[model samples]
Target chain A: MAGLGQTLGRAATWPLTLAARAVDPPLRAWQRRTGTGGMAAVFLAPNLLIFSVFVLVPLVLNFAYSMTGGTGILLGQRPFVGAEQYARLLECQDYTRPITCREDQFWTAVGNTAQFVIFQVSLMVVVSLITALILNRDIRGRSFFRAVFFFPVLLSPVVVGLIWRWILQRQGLLNLIMVKLGLEPEVWLNDRVYAFAATIGVSTWAHMGFYTLILLAGLQAIPRDLYEAAEMDATPPGRVFWRITLPLLGPNLAVVLVLALIRGVQIFDEAYVLTGGGPGTSTLYLTQYIYESGFASLLREPGLAAAASILMGAVLVVLTLIQLWLSRRAEGRKAR
Target chain B: MGRIVLDGITKSFGATQVIHGIDLEIEEGELAVFVGPSGCGKSTLLRLIAGLDRPTSGRIEINGRDVTRASAADRGLAMVFQSYALYPHMTVRQNLSFGLENTRMPKPEIAERIDEAGRMLEIGELMERRPTQLSGGQRQRVAIGRAIVRNPTAFLLDEPLSNLDAELRGTMRAELARLHARLATTMVYVTHDQVEAMTLADKIVVLRGGRIEQVDTPLGLYNRPQNLFVAGFIGAPNMNFFRVRATGGQAELPGGLSLAVPGEGEVTVGIRPQGLHLATGDGPALEVVIRLVEALGAETVVHADAADGTPVVTVLSGQPSLAAGQPIRLAFDADAVHFFGADGMRLEA
Candidate 1:
């Protein structure tokens, strides 16, 4: 009976060992795939889902709503109006009003936004590049200076607007300083020109630091030996900076330009807080126009607001594509 | 061509002095090599000559002009670095023409110079290729070609062949010697390889501990070393030193074994390994126990220990019959042996 039991035990163990070997590889492979896949899904799913609901869904619904005349909440009761809003936009008149009325406000906002983006983004990028170059040098107390420059980027845009508004007020810091010096006190933020200037100044001061830090990183990544070799070859310092440093920094410069352009185009908080699209809408932006059409003031045309937002998104996408194409071409040249 | 002169060149970083009051002169068209172990200031001295670094004190005269305060570009010299230091973004043609371009040379002249340097280096087919696409030897040739186009007063090379593999290093060494001969320009090369110093230099400057130990031709350094350091440094397997006591014009080795000395006083007897032979009969001999034997077909080196446990190596050609733990007698010609005093300076007989 003992011998029979040993034989049965051996018979069972053989099949069990073969089964374990057969299952091991596929099971481990599945475990590895699921482990990485699950971790990736955990990190990416929340942002993807939130963006789809908040950004993508609203974008699609806004395009559909722009083709219709909406008087109620989105996805609720509304009537399809068939391009009437666009026609009204082009005719420079209110469709619902009785007689002919000028609609110069919309066109004025577009021009102001364009001017602001052009002036503000260019000035901000140039200032940031200069600051980054200075900080990249081997100077003492560099980290301290870097922090001091970058402090403004961390502030809320609303707070920045409020702070500048106080500084530019009629009897505010500028006038007070001027009176102390026994000079004539000028009306600072009251006129359209001064208001636009104040808007550009505040935006530049708040955003230049972030771009400076990014460009500094790019500058530091360049090897110092290249400069040494250039010097040995009798290449002058100016030529080294222009030929070697600038061309190598093309990718970083492109990033700063595109980011500044996008932020400049979508500028809303400072203009809304300081100007409220006022002084004849000199500092008004496209976003403020969309907002005033949707909820603020007496215009409650959600379809027009949706159409403007869609148009803004399309412009941003096209601009980003052009920036990407430029970066790729620069990389191709380097490869050659 | 210019005769380079360094007068009282001293360099200090904070408190530590690296190159201490070095003075030397290189006649025009001489291929001089500065060779030493690491941190011996050979590379620093080269940089000083190239005007890449300023001397803490003294003047550098190139062809009888003081260039101590001149910038590297104004000094009119070219250098090849160990890392090759090629501009990765530029093709071979652009790299060769960049220096000329910066000096505002005409476009046609730049093109002509590029073509000439490419053909001279035998890299005409690689002119359009970037540095990353070339092999190590090709890149090195391009680097040399870059230096050649400038027509500088001197060429400074800092271990330019150290980056190549063994086989390519030999080939490049021959090519560099050929290049120097063809160009006939003042060239100062720095290396730590004794063999390279022996083969390529018209004058070898041996350095030790941030100072010049000896400066002479290759055969001069090998045959008549000034000190024990040079004797040990210049030869392969090194000269063996055995401590001896002088009495009555005879030198006594350890363990009471004795040999005749032509002079008096205590001296360290130095003998090159190739000078030693296995005596077939009675001769001036010392008994040694063989520890290890290496056979290389042409020669066999026997590593052995003396009766007093002093280690010694005797190299013999045409394979002697020897084995470990065997007792053997080694003899060397008296004319081939060198004698040094207790202060490590050579003593002439």
Candidate 2:
């Protein structure tokens, strides 16, 4: 029986072998002509071509669009107003009050995004760390709990928004439970404060699983014997966490922090779907405002939207640079 | 005083029991070594005594107080792991003082203890360095320093020297002896190397298959092992066993060699390699064909087979003229012969 299986396996792989043999000579000739560095470029050509078309071209075009004026989407139809859109966006009597700004909605979106990033990133990191620590223990149903926590990460952002919208809507599960408990059932999405808090909570729930998984892996890599030695030394539980667990988890925590910050700054899809920037623009984040200015509103100004997006992109780039710096510092310390 | 007593200790992981019932007492200031092969539960027994692991059914007493159900921290014992287990991010000084800091010890006293440990272990110069920057021997010293700064009830070392290179292991072994003498603290050390057990142990426990085979002093074990497993395990190159039939007080070897022993019926005879010598003239000697010869500077080791194919190893003194395939006569003194009964237990005269 084993002999027959081996013969069948060999027969199944014969075409693969023959195809490799047929392509080998041409590949070898190409390598000989190109050298190793040139061959590497050849192998990377496909990915580089796709990235250029999808990322680089749009970036350059966005920059060009940001310097133009009028409702016209095409560059040739619009007159270049170099830096006027930026000047208009920054023309505010008082930086704190959006009512004094020319682009009041944009200022409001900026305020909302800053608030969201602060609350959501901190909440995400703390919740994910707690979940990871619990899951890392030798408890029963640990794997089941880990998978449950990670289930939201696998769902589409639209699906996550819709699910939370169902739970917190006036006629949804939360209101139903509140009404059953003889309490005044409130319209959660219609209240400014509740809606803003709901957006942060839903976004954190949707993305925290990825961060938790990263922390779980880091927690596992710490050697078990270190904890045993600490126990032998009669270290208090709190000191063990602060001195041993926290210090050792430094690199992973930095990564989670920066990642959560970036993800929080970019929080648009779930909030947009759930709140639709309602409750007097209380949850109208930067990305949603850009979407409304560029394409969704009847009086759409593509140039203003492009300028706002360029500004947002700059913020993201700075954030990404900070993340890179932190990780490099961490790696450098480890190397030393 | 750091005296530990284990009464009816047994440990099992689910359905599989790793340590059988064991009873032992380690006196104050005694260095007891547990020696065995892998999977022999020597380390498990040490961990059980250390309070790092609780036995399935047993009572452990430290200094006349029951600590069987106590937490490892509550038991106040220190352990040095095989991997050193030094905190990577902390300096050697911080590693030494971390436990003391948790106990709310005064800052000055913590510093004093750290300094004293550093001086005692000769690691004062390396205190500012991280564990990764230190060499293996230096990391081992820091590990010991961490344990010593605690001044716990006793010390439990689980194969601590097994990770060191051979030459460093010898140096660390001598250093450990000196440390034990200076501290006068009870210590339970686990290792599979009998040489380490023989040289450093005030009392040695031999284990096999999670059961204690014998417990005695190093010389007592070497001179008089309790069973065949111990008789072979205690010596390097292993003691050779010969199957023979005994009638009255005389036993007959497979190669027609006859010997007087203290057993009747089926008997097994054990002889150490150093116990055999090259025969000079006619005597009660066995003839063997030399298969291999290893000549050290002071002594020569010969691997030979008897006429009926019983393998024998003899360590002969001086560079005697020997080669493979050469027939030789090996003689043994009767006092060096160990007789075992059918059950593998040592037979007493």
Candidate 3:
């Protein structure tokens, strides 16, 4: 039948958007009345609806859960003990020394997360910048090198963590090489500092490729004439890098920094899978602490876990605000 | 001391050679221009002199010092690029001083040079602002100011005014000429706009397809272009060409008219638009059908077609007595005529 063919033909077109076709008339009328911004909003309605349901609802519910007590999954059955879970997280005598805190596990996770973020973020920035600079040059087989640099970013975090875990174990490849070179093998995972270092290195290895890709794009966007002008001025290569390359790459670097900051604060999978909060909790991180307290606990204190996550979010928000301020100042300088 | 000599400089990227070996001498205090259409490698030749690129086979000497292998910085030359290439992050003042400061010059001396360049370029008020804050003309001045602060042996400019609007480009071109007069420094400039070369250069190097078409004074190139390519390229409205049969230094035109040349062969006749006289009563004249008349304020240009459909352009002062779809016979002297042979090479008188 012609009708069946029409329906099948319509269904075959991508994004196979039958719903969009149905709404097209009113959307066009609205666009005619209000212009581009209004039509853009109409196009964005479905995404906004999905985000409100999936992300916003859970965020509000978690805040609600943090103010409650007991094992009840439903909010109506739970008894409210407002601020008690928050107070538990804040019960630190000497905030700098996590061991002195009443909630030692919470403070230990914060301390560990801070150490990991600092080490990982700095290493990530330097390593990615170096890789991006090398890859951006006129080296032979540059596309192949770019793919090689960006390969690990496409990998799953669990796969990345497990692979590193095996390699950093007592009888790993690194130690095997060390032993073959007449050096003693290191007990990498059993030691606290070694385990912490392992986590930072693995996380950097997993994420540096993404940042390198970002920085490489930034490098490409720079006009070649600027470099030529610098060469004309006889600017030394090192000074040119410091003066021209780094300053121009400011916005991309800021994006990498903020994303790394949020990811570091919210990191769980790599450290969790590799260390399992082992070596006397030296590798414990914020998300793993929240995960252990919520579902892995004997009593299953969901409220405590919610409080910890909210605290982590707050720290990330503050860090992001500072980054924005710094980048804005930098952008202002660039304009002048 | 600013004399730069290139002996057999050649450049190639992979298998395709962009610059055939070229030998040239830029005299001290000369404002030399390299002008050609796009892909002519004028900029590449400039880059070779600037030492931003190396020659495949040649020796380059500045003031008799062999600098074929010297880096751009080592060559003590400064360049103003087409994009202006002002450090966007630095203020105008900082841009001028950046190069000087790199050589470990005293801070006070660097400031003195910046002040001098700022005053010379009339950008003193723009010192505190960044490149983005300034207009195109202002950025161009800042770029020039940056070059002046270096006080290098010679200055290289690569189409520094092409980015501006037409009127601004005119102003900048004049300013650049005046700057050269005041500084008396050897300057090598590259541009695709022959007008810029004609108006600015003491010596013009016309190039085509990575080879030098001719090197002469601006009038020397315009009055007597060495070849058909230079004749076509050196004019604004382009030279008019008419196919002609020739024997024994005489050529036959489409309307049974004949022209005398210096040589014998099958040839093409060329005439500048302004070369033809449009007087009602004159000597020998070729009939042309008037197609269109453009009445520009200072001058009027007539576009017409010959009987055989070869396009012809003639320029007259003010408005000329002509109408569309009317036939007019134009007269020109035998001296103004240019003849090219079957090989596309010009026949010199």
| Best model number under DockQ | 2
lDDT of every model, 2 decimals:
0.85, 0.91, 0.89
Question: Ranking under lDDT, best-scoring first?
Answer: 2, 3, 1
Q: How well does candidate 3 score on lDDT at residue A170?
A: 86
Candidate 3 residue A204 C-alpha distance from true site, Å: 0.6
When superposed on Cα atoms, how far off is each prediction in RMSD? 8.8, 2.5, 3.2
Residue pairs in candidate 3 whose N, alpha carbon or C atoms collide under 3 angstroms:
none
Off by over 4 Å in 1: A1-74, A77-110, A138-143, A181-183, A270-278, A290-307, A318-336, B102-109, B237-331, B335-344, B347-349
TM-score for chain B of each model, two decimals:
0.95, 0.98, 0.97
- Per-residue lDDT tens digits of candidate 3, residues B1-349? 5999989988999998999888899999999999998999999999999998999898999999999999998998889999999888789888888888789999989988888998899999999998989999999999999999999899999999899999999999999999999999999999998889999999999988888989999999999988899999998788889878777767767666677766766787899998986847755677889999999978989999988888889988876677889898888877888878788888877
lDDT of 1 by residue, B139-247 (tens): 9999999999998899999999999999999999999999999999999999999999999999999988768889999999988888888988888888888888787
TM-score for each predicted model, relative to the true structure: 0.80, 0.94, 0.93
What residue runs in model 3 are displaced by over 4 Å at the alpha carbon?
A1-45, A320-336
Best by TM-score: 2
